[model samples]
Target chain A: MSARPQVDPRGPRFAAWVTSAVLVAVLLTGWWPLLAAQVVVFAVGAFASLSAAPYSVLYRVLVAPRLGPTDEREDVAPLRFAQGVGFAFALVGTLGYAFGVPALGVVATAFALAAAFLNAAFGLCLGCETYLLLHRLPGSTRTVSDH
Target chain B: MTGALVALGTLLVAAVVGFALRARDGRVRAREDDTAARVPAEVRAALDAGARVTLVQLSTTFCAPCRQTRVLLSDLAARTDGLAHADVDLTDRPELAKALSVLRTPTTLAVDSRGVELLRVGGVPKRENLLAALAPHLPG
Candidate 1:
């Protein structure tokens, strides 16, 4: 019944692994530029189509081909929301590093890395969990109130 | 040296959290306080349809594992007599989630025909574990 386009579930996990690596690099080097680049990637995936994001492109062009095919497809909304969460952390980390606040930068990137690594390693999507928990919060604009 | 330590610390923390989650996920915990709790009308309706036990799955739209759980539960229900599967979307039903104290998706509640909560699983349940847990309540 859903008209939304579904994506290969593997694509997001692959992207998460790449994101974890990028976050690790950013953390190790205190590189604002690299973190900035990752922020852009997350922004694209969050605001635009997830398939158009850099890692997704890599997944389609390089990784997915080798894995043959997967019948398991996932909705894009949660993944995009997760990308938005990544963008928030990456942006904060970039700002912290660019502004000479290394502590803030380290903390933010570490959090992002933690989330990305969980998705990569255990298929646990914290951002997706956040989305669900957010909906359950009171006064959150949910239309249905009966039953 | 500090950077390496930070990175290592981050990985270690994530690993610990992941392990903890993996251990708890899909575990069915019987609710001792659910002896007097009645299921919602939706689930009670399934019981009225002659099902001895109904597996009520609470799922959200964006939950990928929920799709797999749906497949597993529906198949289980189809092959088993007196067992029904009802998937309730929590996307529009925050009140229901609150009423049931369900904070996560792919949560399965095993309810008897009288609407008592037999047991509940928080994540994607292992097939054998679920079957074993429901064995006493099921006919065969």
Candidate 2:
């Protein structure tokens, strides 16, 4: 109800695009390192700023400048929660590849890829939905906004 | 061989899921039409205020499409007599969000004057579809 904190809606989508590309590489090579890099990207976006969240820095400097700043800023918390969801998937996917679990790695990356692609292509946030599900979990603090 | 197949298969699966989510965007589905449990009166009353019908919007502060949902529903409320718009932020009110079974941002609940639930829209609702949803609820 208070004045909503604002962020460019493009930031997350830009980050998703990069995550999707890295995940595709992860699937093709089953390479733990690429997945590791992606896990770090998700962590940065989850807990920190876009400046550190891969490709978002480019968007902030180049794309945001050319866009001339329309009034499309969004609330920041959901985007951060969304990034956390991405991080969980990336972390699990990296572990699967690291442990030689080919099927598990592929499955995790595929699921994460679907989510990232949905955000990048359709502007739908799968992580936001995951955030909602977390709130529904029993007997915990029901607030996701505080975190 | 398996990696190539999974790579191809993964792309195909991604495409299918993407299309499906996009298909459901901004469309209203009346739960009444679907035979779900009736929306409780206290909940409906919280949303309804001196109107023939109320468009209750469930939103979170950071939801992008919720903004679009607010603008459209408020415009509909203005155009229709005895129809009012109510917006609730679920960020701090997750219990209400859970009780309402809201899975996505900008989820909307349509409640009639008698407090019977009419429709529930899961995402951003298109104007045309919203008008049609209201048609049956509108006064003769």
Q: In candidate 1, what are the lDDT values of residues B54-73, reduced to their tens digit?
A: 89998876566787788899
Candidate closest to the true structure, highest DockQ = 1
Write candidate 2's Cα lDDT for B54-132 as tens digits.
Answer: 8888877557677777888899889888788988767766667777777777788888776667888888888888878
- Docking level of model 2: medium
Find the candidate with the highest lDDT and give its number.
Answer: 1
Query: For model 2, what is the C-alpha lDDT against the true structure?
Result: 0.75
Can you tell me the DockQ of model 1? Answer: 0.60
Worst 10 residues of 1 chain B by lDDT: B40-49
**Collision pairs in model 1:** none
Can you give the lDDT of residue B71 in candidate 2?
Answer: 82
lDDT of 1 at B55: 91
C-alpha root-mean-square deviation, candidate 1: 3.6
Q: Report every candidate's CA lDDT.
A: 0.83, 0.75
Which segments of model 1 are wrong by more than 4 Å? Answer: A1-4, A136-147, B40-48
What's the residue-level lDDT of B34 in candidate 2? 53
